[model samples]
Target: MSRRDSLPPLNPTRAFEATGRLLSVSKAADELCVTPAAVSRQVRALETFLGVSLFERIRGGLELTPAGARYLSDLMPLFSALRESTEGVMAGAPGRSNVLRIRSPATFAVRWLIPRLASFHRLHQDIDVQLTTGSAPLDFRREDIDAGIQLGDGDWPETHSQRLIPNELIPVAAPSRARRKGWKLERETLLHSLARPEDWTLWLKFAGFSTANTNRGMRYETSLLAYQAAVEGHGVAIAQKALVLKELEEGSLVAPFDMTLDRGGHTYYFAWPSHRPESKSLKAFRQWLAKVVR
Candidate 1:
């Protein structure tokens, strides 16, 4: 290729990068300060320029194609470097104090974090925590978020992670449902979350039960939805113990069996890019999280 033909159009390249990283045209557009249609057009332009399909439309959202993933892996570092260089030049600019941006799983944020966040606010009145909900893999360089809460072993590459909470799984049902005659795991309707389809199987195995069939159930788009179904006495649902504490404590939901599955290596973690210097807000947040989790 000639020197003039080496690089793709900057706008299309940016649109594709953002879309590929975020996996949503609307989200990419929001980040780019453009319309969703514009983002879509730019992505198409880039795809046409490269002569390859970069994304596949999935049921609920977009999924990167194998080629797209590989391409994104290569493009991310370049974009990160560019952004870092730009920020370096713009350093010392006036900025807000102690404003922290955080991304977390929707259910966790709603059920656990938000409830306890007021305590953190009272403790560090100077700090402002802006929480966003998402369960996608974190790319600190690509995303504007300062920190993210992830459910994993804290092994994400180039991320500094601190364990936040143990992920314990237990089968729970509405009080009425649990007390109903003929209610048993082997017979009651099993509620499943599409996000964690294997949860039931994992819990069942740990509870010394056969993992033969966990597929027959009413599947919801999220754990929150499945838990709601359980709360309505629709079916028995496997729940992350931390996310349903209020329900359990308030007697809205009850665990019939005496078994709890500590989901091995998987746990909630507070993570951020290791390369970035830790800010006062981050330190305060981390310490507050530690105190609360304990």
Candidate 2:
């Protein structure tokens, strides 16, 4: 018989390893989720196969023999290594194609990251980035998504989060017809976004316009649409500073007021599951984002 065939079976070996190391059949049984009698049977089978005494009967329960102690010391590392190797293989099962799957909000994906993707692609040609859009709660267990960009207070449980940017609201309007500083507020038509309907209210209250009707504006489904409307000389839109930075810089839209509403506890974050071991590709992508954010 070959050496592999001559050795005791894995189940019996595991049984004996736990039984001998623990010195209590019931405790080992609890650990193994089997009956104490079943553990004893397996330990006996292992001893019979090896033709050696692995454990000895005691007054209270059992004790490991010197040989059993030595065997357990040798087997523990091997079992641990086997488990770790198996988990390591499974941890990276989703990265077989070297694709970095990222979930993000549609407006942020389009307005911010998409513009900077060309540089990311140029720098990391080997790492393919796949972007999915949704602002819903993130689930890292999904095979299609590895990580996500979230806008909130960064208090999500079971997640490792890195704050990318803070939420700052500023009033912006088209350069062509937007009223300059000190213009009458009642004269301008305020644009609104359904996504952030309270943005105008929040900013208005901060600016001491307590009596203004915040809900009375031409509402759009997204902030990007409102920003576009603002760019078309329609009216002022409460714009997120980061999203409208390019427009502000290029003189397409101008912040008519100097007051920017920076509410604490609201920030943009990139996050992934805390429990899952981060794959190398995901780590690289996260580091790249951290750099971009910096």
How well is each residue in 127-165 modelled by candidate 1, as lDDT tens digits?
A: 778899987888786676778998889999989999887
Of candidate 1, the 10-residue stretch with the lowest lDDT total is 88-97
- Each model's backbone clash number: 0, 0
lDDT of each: 0.85, 0.79
Which pairs of residues collide in candidate 1? none
The TM-score of predicted model 2 comes to: 0.65
Cα error, residue 57 of model 1, in Å, equals 14
Per-residue alpha-carbon lDDT of candidate 2 for residues 126-210, written as tens digits (9 for 90 to 100): 6778898886778543223568998888888878988887689999988767656656666678899887768898899899987
For model 2, the local distance difference test gives 0.79
Clashing pairs in 2: none
- The residue-level lDDT of candidate 2 at 287 comes to 85
Residue 104 lDDT, candidate 1, scale 0-100 = 94
